[model samples]
Target: MGSVTTSHELFEVRRIAIIGAGPSGLAAAKYLIAEDSYEQLDVYEQQPEVGGVWFYSPEIVGVTPVPHTTPRGPPELPIWPKGSPAPLFSNPMYQHLNTNIPKPLMQYSDQNFDSQSRLFPSRQDVQTYLIKYSQDVRHLIKFFTQVADVHLVSKDGKDHWELTSRSIITEEQKTVEYDAVIVANGHYSVPFIPAVQGIEAFNAAYPSTIIHSKAYRSPDAFKNNKVIVIGSAASGLDIGTQISKVCRKPLLNSVKTSSELKLEQENKEEVPPIAEYLVDERAVRFEDGRIEKDIDAIVYCTGYLYSYPFLKSMEPPIVTNGRRVRDTYEQLFHINHPTLAFTALPQKSIPFPLSEAQAAAIAKVWANKLALPSKLKMIEFEEKRIEELGDGAGFHVLGFPNDARYINFMYDWVKTANDGFAKEPARWGSELVHLRERYQEVRKKFVEAGGQAKTLEELGFEFSLKY
Candidate 1:
């Protein structure tokens, strides 16, 4: 059954539904279409267009529906009190945001960007690329359609998903059943603002000023204001540097010390994580026993919570901790329902390539050209992963060795089908490993040089030129 053949009867897939039309969803559609297996394809996008988080919009969309009130509360209950409404569709991209990964590493295995594209493409470049990828399959997509609910129903003695989707404009709802469902709704929508004492009170005192990085756009809005950017991740660093150009003093608040990782701290003041917000004094206290006064705004780049609001049918829930998707076989298929559901979920890695690989493997699995481990084996795999990776943010981050290992594993799994599907460039896995080594060398040099700020181009060329 895990071997390629022309026998359609061997595979049970019929119609398939993809939740989002973003990069992962688009990749899923592309690979599924390549399989030429499914009879019907339905791609649903809640936004008016594709491109998921890459498509930037200044207009604030719906608020983040309180997850605690939902039937399956947040995977890890947030610090927010009951009934806290967050700005739902806040644009995660800023005007000047560029891809964190180099362009060569960002493309799908079968596709390439424009010849003249930059090493780090901008948000517009990414969105345009996605829109073009969807062009061939746009007819199959239902834009402005949201998957309101996904329920498991028994149809003809087989597992079928009853998808309740609604039009955002007309508020009209429709129900459809599919043989399988791919959830590419993305993990970046719900902002995860860490619980900080007095944060709610501070926001109450200065409405609309304190916001998550999702709500961030132009640095012009932050001009002349003293802003403290939290979370030292990619988004936080980019937003902080951009705001530093206009703000009187832009301070970066992070838990990472110079001893941990060499950071470019020459241009901006870096401080310890905020211990608490002094709402009355319009100040903040750092964990290192320091107090900063007269802060005008606080922008949280604390990343996003893993949200699968539509998935309410699972007994134990897909995401048990709100950080890692639990009980999965290779973190791709749900152990209990491998064929019924899948997720192109990857983190802290080159997203497009990883998604493409995951999608190809899933398509083969659905087509019965690729085999999954037995239920007992899958349970053992999940347990081993949790024990090794630990049940924390580390589980979600497929950094370094883990990312390369997963990608290579999928590429190998896909090849087992012998179905002539797309595969990553020969030796791409080696390149990833080499790239990690080079990146560490670059970081080592920067740290040894006393923490001088360097351009991304300078660091990127170290590996790109060699590769």
Candidate 2:
């Protein structure tokens, strides 16, 4: 970590580098561009175009199920034969996926989805929307560039970042220096499959049968097969529901919570977490002493780890157990090194708007228009957060009302930091909060009605001034 004893030298940000051309990275670029103080702003993306994970390819990344034993750092990009096109990074977007959050709440503040688009737009719709949103700063993005390492360096007694990025296709590398860095690369890259008892042997018995949600492309592969879907989160439920239509009757849904056990869906039955795998019997033993035999596939819909193999150089590491980012203040700025910040770290929240809010705050602070609390104060905030939320993934889990409050808080924070020239940040008013509160219900109604509703009003969700 770089040491800064004075405030004047700490916030002297001019040339900034943003990693990832995803929604969060694009938002960061827009806000940073709005601030005329930055001398240079570069957005690095490994993919050929924008839209991060939403930029889907039929090709899926190979699964690495063990989290603890897995090597740290970004996975090495696959090399193609000379003159061949480089393969794209595998994304979690499946064929039949749609936004769980409605377009009204999911969109960035400055843009709206096409009027003809559904209330919960499809995967391709979002990819197109993000590409369109990135038009203004397209010239600033360096596509096909993968940042391999980011380290803190000292020059002229001031702290700066030395970044090394490699070309995914050419296998060429380049190193550059910047005043600050924003790690907006997103966290869904590395899939997190929990260590289950006898899963390795199970995989040996049924090769390619145990898989993570990242590798899932279509439900057709699971058709007429006995399937067990693990984890009951958004992806788990969505994937399980999609498979139930084609899989064997009563698709087994494994969950860790009693609340999720009550999830009622036709052709799907909630089951306890897996206890052991009976390799010889080709069966799974549940925690409740029930064994389900002849299981064809076990899809771990478990979430991803927060990985930044590039930040391996940082002292007092940021990532641990791939669960949550540590030493972050308000889950954005680094406490010891305030200039180093992150966006879209919170899970179970509206991503697009949340990215904008975080980018706005980071931009304001980096531009010297907004002041951050002292290092001691920032450290205290994180300590309090860990005490309240505990550690691991829960440290960054901002669900429902917390997500609403966070965006609004960023709005107010940036408003106070405004120098009369900054663009207005996204403000979550009572109506937006109300809509967000009932997002699941609205999405459920839409899905139940065949997902044909083109607008919230069409789904009977009206925009009201009153809560």
Candidate 3:
């Protein structure tokens, strides 16, 4: 219900509609407001609340907690009130849930959490952090509005967009126009439930036990009961890891969850070639051999698929079969749809603070180009590379081959994006360790067995520093 834009904010913005009030959308609003760039910015988020996907958890069955030994990043900042509405997922998670990312690496370049914090912050703690972020920039957000659809509009010879939205609180539909829109509405809104045979029949025969990991809040859902968790992604691991110590034998249907080939078990070496198909033709079964039919619960750690209903008509959809649209020059902006950008999406990595810095770089260049600034029109290899990449080839966010993941700290990637290349800002600051150390100590270890080395030379990195 808050937006930083006063009645007179000295912005040329017509009217902008942001479709989600989560981190990315809120971040964008902060920039637009603090930078005094937008004339009017209104964010629409369904569910009568903010924190979209992190909104709620509904219990069904088989979802329980086990020992939580998963690696973590930093804690989340809670933005929601302690006494929100229904939706058990809305309740605070157990004390053990932390990010898969480490604290030092995930902190924004401009700020760091208190030094006395844990290595990775808990989900609730991080939510509290986001709440702080929201408070700091509360004037930039509007909650309880869900965007239904948007249509492109052309006036005279110029193009603009008309957005259609419904205020859940007011129960009123409204229309607005904008010069640009940033769809911070992320993927994972809908669960990716697998279409395994007999699933529907199994549900009919034994209703209410099947559910997705998103519904799981705590082990309270599975006390003195056997549980089953599917999917092998981070969430799957987190949930399964938690439920394992509790569930009699939390059966898992290991599949192509991780880009890497390692399957980690507590106190066990990472396993390889994870079983693609469960042996009994059933993802989970019970001991009585009731045709493998009944179970206390079945948690589909089933991964989520990225979707953009707005971009449905964009020819090659932005994502294909759980994979992103092919080819990105700098791996940031969409090749074919230059006006549209997916800032925080990753290929094989989790969310990190680096995304914010990267988003800022893209935004600067984008604003300059839109306003026809000469600084952006200059000649350079970086620009050419970006232009070449705009050809619609290599239009993927996961980088090439879709096998490995990489994050270069050079910041030159964004340089290639806007002016074709330039030195990163010293104000951007440096991490605890140099880029060389990151590569030698971190990057090299993540490569698959037969991967090739991608150094500054190959990456068009002209400068050198310690690793």
The prediction achieving the highest TM-score against the true structure is: 2
Runs of candidate 3 exceeding 4 Å displacement: 1-15, 33-37, 47-96, 250-253, 256-294, 310-337, 369-410, 413-467
Model 2 root mean square deviation, Cα atoms: 2.2
Residues 1-467 of candidate 1: C-alpha lDDT, one tens digit per residue: 12221223344788899988888888888888888878999999877788988877665544433111122343221122236331124457777776656555677766666655554567887888888878888888998787888887665555678899887667799999887889888887667776678777877786765777877878898788888887766777677777877887545555555323334455478788888888788888998889888888778777776768788666667775577777677778877666544555667777787787788887888888877766778889888878988976677677777777777778777887866654332225455567654554544454445433233344434443321
Ranked candidates, highest TM-score first: 2, 1, 3
Model 2: per-residue lDDT, tens digit, 83-167?
Answer: 6476577788889888887888988888989988898999989999999999999999998898999999877766789999998
Q: TM-score per candidate, in order?
A: 0.85, 0.95, 0.65
Model 2 accuracy (lDDT, Cα):
0.84
Better of 1 and 3 by lDDT: 1
Alpha-carbon local distance difference test for all models: 0.70, 0.84, 0.47
Worst ten in a row by lDDT for model 3: 67-76
The TM-score measured for candidate 2 stands at: 0.95
lDDT of 3 by residue, 1-467 (tens): 11221112222335556667766666655555544444677766664445555444342323222211121212111233357453222322334566544444444444555554544555655665566666665555656555666565555433456777765556588877775666777655435665554456556555557767655677666665555666665576666666765665534444443423232344112122222223334334322222332357777765455556654444444555543433333445444333344555554443444455445544544444222122222223225644554432222334322211234442444444434333232122233333323432332232222122233333232333211
lDDT of 1 at 145: 81
